[model samples]
Target: MEGILNAVVLFSNFVLIPGMAYGSQLALGALGVTLIYSILRFANFAHGDLMAFGTMFVILITWWLQSIGVGIDPLPTALLALPFGMAAAIAISLLSDRFVYRFYRRNKSPAVIFVIVSIGVMFLMNGLVRVIIGPNDQEFGDGARFLIKVREFKEATGLNEGLALKLSQGLTIAVTFVVVIALFWFLQKSRTGKAMRAYSDNEDLALLSGVNPDKVVIVAWVIAGSLATIAGTLYGLDKSFKPFTYFQLLLPIFAAAIVGGIGHPVGAVVGGYVVAFSEVTVTYAYKKFLIYLVPESWEPESLVQLLSTEYKFAVSFVILVVVLLVRPTGIFKGKVL
Candidate 1:
């Protein structure tokens, strides 16, 4: 029984908790991508860099707040600075829509054109973020680091293995739940939400039924901007923030969005967990846990990891390719590519 408990603890520590937190972040990012695709009819390749831009704002504001000696005890000061980050992200999104995307949209340009434009936007945003924040890792999380420390858990349980829960992990899960609920509620019950859905379902019919196209577009960008900011900030808190890391993050984010069915919000959320768990489970070294469970005589010589940590991101790409090949519509019956 002690061995079993140890195995469970080990698995939970290395796989379950990390996956959940990472999943929550991916869900938020995927939701943003899905929303823009559904409403605007284009894949915004710039979305990842946009997240970095928003997170940069949060990091800056967090620094300013800390310098002024203002902080939330037990929680990271980044939480307090999130709103400012969202505001800046929203402003940039709106400006991009107005100055760059608006012309092509008005001209009824093909979706491919919009995609190419978004790639250009992605490069610009990536460069802008590098200029503002530099190309290095930034640590903005300051306060209570863990909700439950490993030593405390081991002492409390008198167990051979311990479970550690970080404050950032708890925050990520809680904030994601609240944000997702609010988003679904807004989509289901709010007037603008209905209008947006109507527009998504059929733009000509919605326009004929008195739905304002411009308003729907603006609302989509606003929601996407907010999601991007929250997801990026939460991830930076959980890990460390580096501009290039976010750019690399685009692959997983896009994979999550596509895997879940590109235009479906619910699919996006589900997809995030799938991708996160796959990545964690595949890359984790299971040698220690196996030793805890198996007899000493039967213990393996090598670590039982399927892939190295450096290739973790590649897991998402492989899954993406498989999903695209097997079921292009994804798990949710989303729009077929």
Candidate 2:
């Protein structure tokens, strides 16, 4: 029984908790991607860089605040700087839409053209972020490091295994809950949200029915920008902020979005947890976990990991390929990609 308890605790510490935090981050990112695809009718390849850009601003603001001796004890100082970072991100998103996307939208360019343009934008944003913050990892997290300490847990439970929960993980889950609720409310009840939905469903019909295309597009960008910033900031708090890391995150983010159903918001959230857990579970070395459950004679001699941690991203790629091949519309029947 004690071994079983220890096994559960160990699994929770290494896999469950981290998976949830990572899922929340991925969900937010996937939401942004789905929003743009639903409304704008194109996948924004630059979404990852958008996240990096917003996080870069948040990091700068956090540093400035720390230098001035301002902070919210027990809470990340990044929270205080979030609004400013969001605003900056939103501004850039709008500017990009106006200068780059709007022209193509006006000309009624094909989705392929928009996709190519987004790739260009991706490179541009990536370059800009690297120039501003450098390609090196940036450590900006500051606050209470843990909500539950391993030593404390062991002492309290008198168990061989301990569970530790980080403050950033808790914050990520909490903030994601709030954001998702607010988004659902807005989409379900607000006039603007309805218009956006109508446009997404049928642009020609929506325009004929007096839905302003420009307004819908603007709102989509605003929401996407906000989500990107929040997700990036939360992820940075949980891990370190590296510009290239976010770029690499593009694979998992897109996988989550597609797996959940590209145009479906609910699907994005669900897909996030699915991808996160899959990656964490598959990469985790399960030798100790099995040892806790099996007889001494059956104890494994080698790590029971399906794949190394370094190949975790490949899990997302495989899932993405499988989903695309089996059901292009995804689990929620969002849109045929």
Candidate 3:
């Protein structure tokens, strides 16, 4: 029983907690992508870079605050800078839409054209972020690092394995829950939300019904920008911020969005956890876990990992490919890709 408890604690520390936090981040990101696709009818390849861009602002503001000795104890100062970051991201998003996407939208260009243009925008934002923040890891996390310390847990539980919960992880989960609830409420209940939904359902009919397309588009960008900033900031606080790392995050974010059902908000959130847990479970070394569960003589000599951590992203790719082949519409029956 003691060994069993230890194994569970170890698993939670290494896999469950991290997976939940990562899933929350991915869920937020995929939500942004799904929003753009659902209303704007195009895959914003620049979404990841937009996250990086917003995070860049957050980092800069955090540094400035720290320099002035301003902080909120037991919580990261980045939280205070978050609104500014969201504003910057929203401004950029609206500007891009006006200058780049609006032209295509007005001309009634094909969706493919919008996609290609997004890729171009992706490169430009990626470069701009790199130039501003440089290609290095930035650690802006401060204040309370752990909500539950490993030593304290071990002392209390008398277990060989200890569980440590990070403040960032807890914050990520909490913030995601609130954001998701608010988003769903707005989408289901608000007048603008209904208008947006109607427009998405049938643009021509909605236009005839006096639904303002411009207002819907602006609202969509604002929501997307806010999601991007929050997701990026939470992720940076949990792990570390590196421009290229966010770039690499694109694959997993897209995979989560598609796996849940592109253009489906609920699907995106569920797919995020699915992808996160799959990656963590596959890459985790389970030698100690098996040792605790199996008889001494039956214990394995080698690590029981299905794949190395370095190949974790491949898990997302595989899942994406499988989902695309088996159910292009995804788990929630989103639009066919």
Candidate 4:
């Protein structure tokens, strides 16, 4: 029983909880990518930078709220400032559509053209975020730090292993659940969402059936912007926000989207968990976890990790390459591109 308990605790601490939280973040980010690919029909390479931009706004607002003596007790004030960040992100997305994307869209440019333009947009947003946030890590989460303290868990369970649940982890999972449910509801039931789906299915058919292409594009961008802000803010709260870190996140985010099925929302969510768990499980030093489970004489000397933490991000890329080579349609039958 003691061995079993220790094993459970080990898995929870190193794999289960962290994977779920990180999966939630990736799910949200991948959902945004999938939405753009579904509706706009191009990979929005600018998405990670958009997340950084939105998170930058949230950090600023959170700081302002803290300065003014306004806060949510036991919860991060960043949560309250989230809506403002989302709004700013939406405005920027709309403006970009009007000024930048709109021109290419009007010319009926090829998908590659849009992808290239998104790369340019990505650079612009990256530069803008760096200028505003100064390329430094910013910690904005302010409130109760842990929902469950390690000592409290150890005492309650009378166990050698203690489980610590951070507030940010709980918040990330909860928010992701709420957002995902709402998104699925919108996509599966709402009229405008149906129009978006119809547009995605066949552009000419959707237009002939009176689905307004412009309205669909606007709705998709709005959803993408809102999702990017929430995902970015939650990530920053859970970890620390750095402009470059979000840029790095693009690899995993895109990998999740591609692995799950580029244009499929459900695939995006599943792919997020897949990528997250793979990264954690592959890189985690399992020597300690194994020691508690194995017989005393059988203990191993080495860390027994598959890869170093420095190569964690590469896990996603490797998975992505394998998935593309094996099943480009992803787990779902989404467009290969």
lDDT of 1 by residue, 101-214 (tens): 999999999999999999998999999999988999998999998999999999999988899999999999999999999999999999999998889888899999999889
Error of 1 at 128 (Å): 1.2
State in Å the error of residue 246, model 2. 0.4
Model 3 stretches astray by more than 4 angstroms? none
**Backbone Cα, N, C clashes tallied per candidate:** 0, 0, 0, 0
Write candidate 2's Cα lDDT for 30-111 as tens digits: 9999999999999999999999999999999999999999999889999999998899889899999999999999999999
**lDDT of prediction 3:** 0.95
Model 2: runs farther than 4 Å from truth? Answer: none
| 243 Cα displacement, candidate 4 (Å) | 0.3
lDDT score of residue 110 within candidate 4:
97
RMSD of each: 0.9, 0.7, 0.7, 0.7
Higher-scoring candidate on lDDT, 1 or 2: 2
The C-alpha stretches of model 4 lying farther than 4 A from their native spots are none
Worst 10 residues of 3 by lDDT: 194-203
TM-score of 1: 0.98
Regions more than 4 Å wrong, model 1? none
* Cα-based lDDT for every prediction: 0.94, 0.95, 0.95, 0.93
